[model samples]
Target chain A: MSVIEIKNLTRDYGGKGVFDLTLSVESGETFGFLGPNGAGKTTAIRHLTGFLKPQKGSCAVNGLDCWAESPKIHGSLGYLPGEIAFFDDMTGLDFLNFIAEYRRVKDKTRMRSLLERFELDARGKIKKMSKGMKQKVGITAAFMHDPAALILDEPTSGLDPLMQSRFIELILEENKRGKTILMSSHMFEEVERTCRRVAIIKNGRLATVDSIDKLKAAQVKKYVITLENEKAALAFAKEFAEEDVSETRVTVSIAGNIRELISQMNKYPVAGISMPGQSLEEIFMQYYGGNKNV
Target chain B: MFNATLFKSGIKGGIKTLALFCAVLTMYYLIIVQMFDPALGKMVQELAAAMPELMAIFGMNLNSATLTGFLASYLYGFIIIMFPMIFSILSVNRLIVRHVDGGSLVFLVAAPIKRRDVAFTQMTVILSGLLALTLYVSVLGIVASEISFPGELETGKFILLNLGALALHMFIAGICFLSACIFNETKYSVGIGAGIPVLGFIIQMLSNSGEKLEGFKYATFFSLFSTDGLIAMRPNAVWGMVALFFCAIALFISAIAVFTKKDLHI
Candidate 1:
């Protein structure tokens, strides 16, 4: 079932080319929202969180309209923004406890466990903690409520490798527990490793939404070869239906059934061959348009 | 549910401002009492007679040119009132801008708390702390008056006058809070909040200069708490007291209304 449904969502801030964005995420699935900076990822998230009312169409979390029932919907969702600012004077423990109290639920044991897992000091003031530690605190606060849906934007931007792995583990556990996650991230490897499906957004519009398998299938694959005999390489190239042929070295584009192409290549006097696997990074780069930062 | 958080934030904000005010007041008192020469008494008396009613807005009275009166003048005029004004400005700025800049306001808005409730809690915190500090100063003033003036000070009348002055400060703080709530931009909010009271202070000065523009008196919250008028202990300051109390209520309600309608920019 779809946990979040955004139908032709449009938001205009009296600015020029922002806000005609549309996307959706299903329940119990890790849906990755991929885009470059200022591509309206945060803007769309803001609309979804009901921070900004949509100028057109509708955004409903679960079945609750974001604008009409924000408070009720907010109670069941955990959101971790791309950048989090904390109360500097508050200790990590105090801040977390305060949020817990505001939510009107007590689960200190889970909070303590999360702190231990993140290797965060509960007693340290937020101002004294490093940026990465502060990000960890944000993550902790988002998950403390144990909401049914999680909207995490750039959730792992500042974490070390070990902590990143732990966060990935935590995300997976939440997903397994049937929480829907809409994560916006630049880290394709992280998305590829965890997200079941991915949505590529370009210039505040939906570019594509496909499963990893489908994306890999639709992607253009490259295979490189070094032939011992130039004549054999030419002969293989003639027999094969691959384009962009060169003398000793050749690169082939394969959409399906690469086994035949590999077999034909084997028939040639090949010294060495390399066929790089299709990565989400390549896919992101292909669709990301002008924002090179992606 | 909201009162607890509101009270906590208010008390914390007030205490910080109170500390700053008390420190300045104590320094001014010590200098006036211990450092001045007795031969300067004649010069002080001459200066006291020339003092305008405008200068009394700062709680300054040259009539009693002694250390205690000097302290009262400073505290009454700008120091005490400035504490609440500065506190309101800073606290409101933190709520509007710092929260937006820090990105924590997003988290707060995304939570179950209503926009109106958030504003209410913040205002409560600010007012509670101001009330506490005002009471503390009143008590401190009673002690200081007893010690500095010996038998000349009437504790009962002095307390009533100070209470009236604190009520006026409360009304000004309410205006600041309402301004902060009405505007999302912190600078604009701070500008109007801080500027309004300073403008009133200037008007009070003009009025003291004896121009017949008593209309300015209606706009100045300080007029309602005029220390000289209250200290006179007349039977007709009831109008001022009623206006002062009503202004506080009206400002607070307006703050809530504006908060409910205004966009949560942060």
Candidate 2:
């Protein structure tokens, strides 16, 4: 059964809110919500979390209607807001304890584990904590309950790369334990790493919803082939359609056609080989019409 | 429906401001209670008769020689009325408007408590704080007066005065709380939250300008309680209290309804 369901949830904020959006996350499946800023990512999550009531349709969590049965569903779900707004005078420890108390968790084992895993000391006043530290506090509060489902809005935002990777590892570990997770993020790499299926929202509309494997399979991989000399590279470039036909370098972009390229490359005197840094942007670009809203 | 945790935090967060206002009121109330003299009251009456406009602005009655009249005109008239209105406005703004604007309310609602519960808890906190402040200051003032000058201060009249002040604050707090629930942005929320009470204070002041505008007192939320009138149990005082009670309940209902259904798209 689906742990989360949003059907035709529309809340018009001057033609900017989510419109006719329909999506669902199966129990134990980590679903990723991908979208640019102001693209209704946070708005949709708010409805699922029951912070915002839908004007048009419905969002449900754990088979309970979101708007009608909000408090009931919140007991089984954990949520992190896009921006952490902590009490001005409280320490991180105080904030975590308050949330734990509210959620009625008896054992502090999970809270302690989350704190240690995130490397958060949680002793200083939140007002004094750095943005990354505050984000760590938010992450800790959201996961400490060990709820059956979690909704995180740009959860990895504001963390350093090391912390971001740790967060991805944590999500993977939690998802392995059969927790239903729905996370919204503009960071494609993090989404690719942790999510099984992803839905892309652009300008308050769903652009695409597909499995990560299929999306990755459909991505264009670029290989920059360097020949022994400019003459060979030029001749090789002529035989094959390429991006940059320089003196000794020819860049090939294709969707999983490395076998065809390998046959064509063998006929030339290959000098060096390299691929530029990889990005999910290459495939996501088509949805945005080359506007790289990243 | 109220969540214990949210209500506790609401009271906890408001204690500092509430205490500060209470301390200031306590010190001033005690000082004046100690300073109360029959001779001073007579002198104040003479001054008020000479400058009726100045006296009316403070809601001063002509009978200033009595202990009840002295406190009513001197304390309850302007400072007492102004302070509680400010406290109510500030408390609601902090407890509701600020949290909503800052997006911290999302965290509270993100808990098992529904949005309605969160709003209810906040309403309870604001109401409780104002009630506590009224009770504490009244008790402290009476205690200080009894210790300093036994049987000199009118206890019955003072209690009546406090009730009137409490009712007025109840109504003012409702307006501020309702304002907090109506708007989402900090600027607009706090603007209305603070604006309404401040406007009432101004109207109350203007109504005291002369007899021609005395009827305008009914237009202000603060008119529910006049310390002098409450002590005397005037006919209008009963109607004022009744009016405030109904308006407060209606505003409270609207506040909860609006907050429960408002779009918190954080």
Residue pairs that clash (backbone atoms under 3 angstroms), model 2:
A230-A247
lDDT of 2: 0.84
Once superposed on the true structure, which residue ranges of model 1 sit more than 4 Å away at CA? A15-22, A221-294, B1-17, B26-45, B50-74, B94-97, B206-221, B234-238
lDDT of 2 by residue, B200-224 (tens): 7888887897888888877966767
Model 2 chain A poorest ten-residue lDDT run: A285-294
Report the TM-score of chain B alone for all candidates.
Answer: 0.79, 0.93
Q: Write the per-residue lDDT of candidate 1 for residues A36-122, one digit (tens) a residue.
A: 666677777877787767778888998889876787888989999888887677888888887887776577777888889999887
Query: Which candidate leads the pack in lDDT?
Result: 2
> On residues B48-134, what C-alpha lDDT tens digit does candidate 1 reach at each position?
567754444344565444433444455555665566566656656665546654567776678877766776777766666566666
